[model samples]
Target: MTAITGALAMAVAMGLGRFFYTPVLPAMMTGLGLGPAEAGWIASANYVGYLLGAVLAAYGWAEGIERKVAISGLVATALLLLAMGVSSNVLVLAIIRFLAGLASAFVMVFTSAIVLSHGLAASKPWVQSSHFGGVGAGITISAAMFGLIILADSGWRTAWIMAAVLAFAGLAVVMRYLPRDIVRTGPARKEPPLAWTPSLAALTIAYGIFGFGYIVTATFLVAIVRVGGGSSLFEAGVWLATGIAAAPSVAYWMPAVRRVGHANVFALGCLVEAIGVAASVLVPLPAGPVIGGILLGGTFIMVTAFGLQLGRQLANESPRRALALMTAAFGTGQILGPVVAGYLADWSGSYTWASLAAAAGLLASGAIVLIYCRPRAA
Candidate 1:
């Protein structure tokens, strides 16, 4: 039942609320006649709201906001995705997306705490990884839906309605099933306890840089390919396939990291991720995007999975504050990736500059991970 709750919670509260935007955005821009800057601004608004939510939750002001909060957040996000289809005003849509993103941040904090307390254990890396896969699953669903309806010349509203329906169903499951005790891992660690150990701080900074790097490609990879002259189906297919394949890829990636050491494993992930991003800059071909998606899909999720694990391994802080600090670093970087990419694209008149910048950040993160993380004993 707890696993079911985690799965459903992720599908609604964390997954669709956070990830569906990018997959559907291409169809949106085409059907709705939206501009790049406006689209970027909407994405930025989501991140800003996410940032605020993370900071608030990390500071202990977010106590009353747990299981029920997740249900409300998912409900709002589902409705907003539908609302986006009907509303023509960009400002209105941005505000809706911002709130949804904020909702997503809080949901992640709560659900992740649940997992750490019960679901996350050494014997269950693959099982725990599936929960993270929910985000990709949401993206796949949204992208596939958009591809089918878009070819039919159906409006973006159809996609939003679908997202809403999915969310409402997930919410019903959460209400019926999620455990009520909410205290993850015995009594919670004392409030205001120290959160940033040397290892934890390195972990946090590395997580932030990873966030900065990954979002640039995830947010804009399809758009860049579209601009570079790839067909719509090509972009959509790669996106969906990445989301679908990512669940299993963690099995391959995390163990390799565990054996090779976290620092080197993380470096390899960054290296591969950078290669994919760099390809997006040059190839503009179907092969380039597909390969990029495979690599990106495989490792990014592992980085996240391990970041949380690594922090917990090293820290003596509350699950709430420790996870929040690590994730807040991640979320902060994610929030910036798109807006910065947008500005670079706007000024340079090409997506290459933005992508290259993202690639550089990934390498930089690799350096941080290698330097700061102590090598495990062989």
Candidate 2:
């Protein structure tokens, strides 16, 4: 029951609250006369909210009232989506998105803590990773909604309205099933000396780079494909492809990570993601977006899971603090990506430079992780 609810909560928090924007972007642009720069600004606003939310989570404020806050966040997110449909003001949209980001962060942090801690105590660590499948499920469902809107020739406002409805449905399920009491598996081992080893520092930086590295593509891929000669069907198809690839990624990769070790798998995932990012620019027509979507979807969530798990191992003494720092770094990187990419696209009249730059960041991130986190010679 906990696992089921955990995945559903994630779908609502991340897939709907965060990523539904990807499929909705082109529609909003066409309907609202929003340019790449304005769209980027709106995206950045959400990310900034995410950063703020991460900070709050890190500080452990609202610990006792987590359930109330998490439920409120989900409700707020649904209302915000409905609000987006009612307004065309860019500033208003930005504010709504920012608030939605806060809601999403609360749900993610609180629900994961409740779900994973309970699962761990029950000797079901695998259920913890399966919880992320909710993200992919949410994305796929959102894409399907967007596809239907396109087929009906409905405008962006209608899309937002429908999405809000879906969010409410999800919220209802979550409210009914999410565990009220989370059982942590006691304390996490004796406190290890809090030391900043080179590897730890490198992993932290690499994690940030990964955040910046992926956000550009993740935010703009549908838009880019639309401009690059894709039909509405093709545009929706790519996003659905992304969700499909993402859904099973953690399960598929966890065993491999266990065998090869977290550092190697983390490095490899980054490198693969870099290739995917570059492919979006280098390949022509639909091939680039299609193949790129698969690769990006396949790795991003896995890399996140891997990085956070690795952080827990490193900060054995204070896993929450370590995870918080990593989340902060990631949120900071994400806040910058869309703003820069959006303006760069506006100035250059293309996304080529932005995609290339993001790919390079990913490559550099991979190198740092490989070199610094590599196992020392025996």
Q: What is the TM-score of each candidate against the true structure?
A: 0.91, 0.95
Query: Residue 201 error for model 2, in Å?
Result: 2.6
TM-score of 2: 0.95
**Candidate 1 at 314: error in angstroms?**
2.4
Estimate every model's Cα lDDT from 0 to 1. 0.73, 0.84
User: Per-residue alpha-carbon lDDT of model 2 for 210-317, expressed as tens digits?
Assistant: 889999999999998988989988889999999999888888888878788877888889888888888887899789998888999998888887788887777666
Model 2 alpha-carbon drift over 4 Å, by segment: 185-197, 376-378
Residue 249 CA displacement from its true place in model 1, Å: 3.4
Ten contiguous residues minimizing lDDT sum, candidate 1: 181-190
Count the clashes in each prediction: 0, 0
Cα-based RMSD of candidate 2: 2.4
- Let me know the TM-score candidate 1 reaches against the reference structure: 0.91
Please name the candidate that would achieve the greatest lDDT relative to the true structure: 2
Candidate 1 CA-lDDT value: 0.73
What lDDT does model 2 reach?
Answer: 0.84
